[model samples]
Target: MGQVDPHRPPWVFDCKLTARTTPNPEKFDEALRQHVGRPGHWIDLEVRGDCSDAELELIRRLAQEADTRPVVVRHVAKLISAGQEEAGHDEPS
Candidate 1:
């Protein structure tokens, strides 16, 4: 896990990512609930391996509705791989 800079504000929003094959509307609502009055809160997606297009769309919508900045979906894959490497997993050639 990456260390948080103490100088930065603590995160306020946390949303677990839905499976690529399944999307839970209830979860979306729950995540949005955290957005109330916390526009500066960082939304963290708990992706299980990979995130689906639908999941990304839902996150984008939520971000827009919550008046938060949109995140770049492209970096998710790289970040995941980096995390795996940090955990001592060897990448296949």
Candidate 2:
């Protein structure tokens, strides 16, 4: 895990979502691809505290609406971690 910066704003907990709600499995897969692959299609969301009530509700709704099993959802934490790693590579020895 990377060090959490104390000075950074609380937006760090903010997550990005990828969703699909087609009526069939095949079309749902395509929707997932379109939302996950394209930029801006993913929405930025924040959990006020450690956990987010609204986010959970949205996830539940998405799961219920998904046409296929295992509704996929990705968060921004991984992205932030990757960026941190990239930046760390340039740090002074």
Candidate 3:
């Protein structure tokens, strides 16, 4: 959590790291698609801080135009807070 920066979107708290991988544009999209399709439940794609303009655009597409394969999605950005960050937890600056 941004204990030092209050203006940070509350959406920051609700994020869950569903995957980690090398920087490959195709794989980023592919992995997110697969993850949201997992059989356990419906997953809303929540996005926060982006490292680049490309990434911002990518998230925009996913949260807007991403209806490719295995799922039909017309996403709406609904912010849900997971409250505060736990001890020893940190988000990249």
Question: Tens digits of per-residue lDDT for model 3 on 33-93?
Answer: 5545545444455443324557655565663444433333333333335664343356689
Return the lDDT, model 3, position 30. Answer: 69
State, as a TM-score between 0 and 1, how close model 2 is to the true structure.
0.26
Off by over 4 Å in 1: 1-48, 68-71, 78-93
Query: Model 2 scores what on Cα lDDT?
Result: 0.44
Off by over 4 Å in 2: 1-33, 36-51, 72-82, 85-93
User: What Cα-based lDDT does every candidate model obtain?
Assistant: 0.48, 0.44, 0.48
Greater lDDT among 2 and 3 belongs to 3
TM-score against truth, every candidate: 0.31, 0.26, 0.29
Which pairs of residues collide in candidate 2? Answer: none
Candidates 1 and 2, the one with greater TM-score: 1
Candidate 1 deviates by what RMSD?
Answer: 11.2
TM-score of 3: 0.29
The better candidate by TM-score, 2 or 3, is 3
Can you list the residue pairs that collide in candidate 1?
Answer: none
